[model samples]
Every structure is written in C-alpha cells, then in structure tokens.
Target: MGKTTRYRFREYHVTAVADPMALPIFEAVCVTGEERNCAAASGELHAPEELTRWIAGHCAQTGHQSYEQTTRTIVRAEPGAWQ
Candidate 1:
C-alpha cells in the first residue's frame, strides 16, 4: 500500500507519492501548460505543508503564483496484495 498527495497550484499539478519506485520517494510540481514539464524529487517523504512550500518555490521559479491545494487523492498507482 502507498499514499499519494496531490495538490493543485495556479498553473501546476504537484504530487508527492509514497512509492519506492519514485526517485527519492516523491515527485512535485508538474507544470500544466508545458509539453516538457520539469518534475522534481525529494529524498524523503514530506508533510503536505512542506510539499506546498516546495510547490510555491517551483511556481515562483517560473514567476508564477501558486494558489491553495485544490484536491487530495489517495491513489494506488501500483497493484499488490493489501487490505
């Protein structure tokens, strides 16, 4: 089993997933309007607040403003035996 935290910025879709397969175990700030979006990873799991801060930095890097988290979903990107 795994947990995924998805957040919506003004022009970004940030998601941090607790999956071993993910580099550093998390990914963040996928720019919504670009065909070649840059995704960043973290070495460890972060709280939603931390992830939001990361998202803000990512947005600020591009001179964009990030709003609040629009949604949070616990998705099972991988299949396995779990209760």
Candidate 2:
C-alpha cells in the first residue's frame, strides 16, 4: 500500500497598494450617447483629480454628461493566520 499523504492550505488576504514605483493607473471612458464613444483617458493611479479634469474637459467639449471610470490598482496578497 502507498504511504498516506496530506497537504495543508493557507488563507490569503488581498489589499490594494499604491507604490510609487508601480503606481496604479486610472482609466476613464466616455459613455454619453446611446453607444459607447470617445477616446479613453488614462492617468496616474493616486491622482484622480487629473482623471476628473479630463472627464470635465471631455464633457465640455462633447457636451457629454455621463462617463464610465475604471481604476486599476495594484494588490498584494498575504497569508493569514491558520484557522
């Protein structure tokens, strides 16, 4: 008979981190009309103001009031205490 084998698994917790070296990225898309349109905008992760400014400019130029914003952030997973 084969020897009995066992394995252990550990739980992990994921959290977002803003590292200067690997700054998160912010992406915004204009969705004002019936169909998705306009060029996508992207900027630094920590600075949302820049994205907002771009959105405002796009809205003003294209008379668009609606927009979809996507934030891409870095995350780290750490093992949690064994339960």
Candidate 3:
C-alpha cells in the first residue's frame, strides 16, 4: 500500500481603515480555517472581502471615527497544495 498525504487550509481576513485626514492606517482581522492549527495548509480570503469586513467592524466598534476610507484584502495559500 502507498502512503497518503494529508493537507490543510487556513484563511485570514486582513483589513484596513483610515481617517479622513489623509492618514493611512490599517489593521488585520483574522478568520482562520479549520485546518489552521495544522502547520501544513493555510489560506486566506481575497482582497476585497477581507478589507470590507475589517472596515465595517472597525467602524461599528469605533463609531465610524474615520472617513474617506479604502479597503483591501489578501489571500495566503500554503505551498504544495491543490487549491
């Protein structure tokens, strides 16, 4: 019998929020996957969704203290995995 390899995947939601004063500030909101604990597989959400959720949550919590906002998200996938 041949040996089988196991894989894992994790997703993180990175986000950023800025103030209207032209000061670019950013933050990260991590939404990890089930296999995130595994050191093998890891992944993250695309850009748009990650940024949006981050900003929204930040604003909601902080009472929309900032203005003229921009958002961005990123996906980090593990190597040697069939995504």
The numbered model that scores best in lDDT is 2
User: What's the candidate order when arranged by decreasing TM-score?
Assistant: 2, 1, 3
lDDT of each: 0.49, 0.69, 0.43
Off by over 4 Å in 1: 1-26, 64-83
Q: Is candidate 2 or candidate 3 better by TM-score?
A: 2
Ranking by lDDT: 2, 1, 3
Tens-place lDDT digits, model 3, residues 7-48 = 987655543443334433333443323554212111233354
Candidate 1 vs 3: which has more lDDT: 1
Ranking 1 against 2 by TM-score, winner: 2
Compare candidates 1 and 3 on TM-score and give the better one: 1
Q: Which ten residues in a row have the lowest lDDT in candidate 2?
A: 36-45
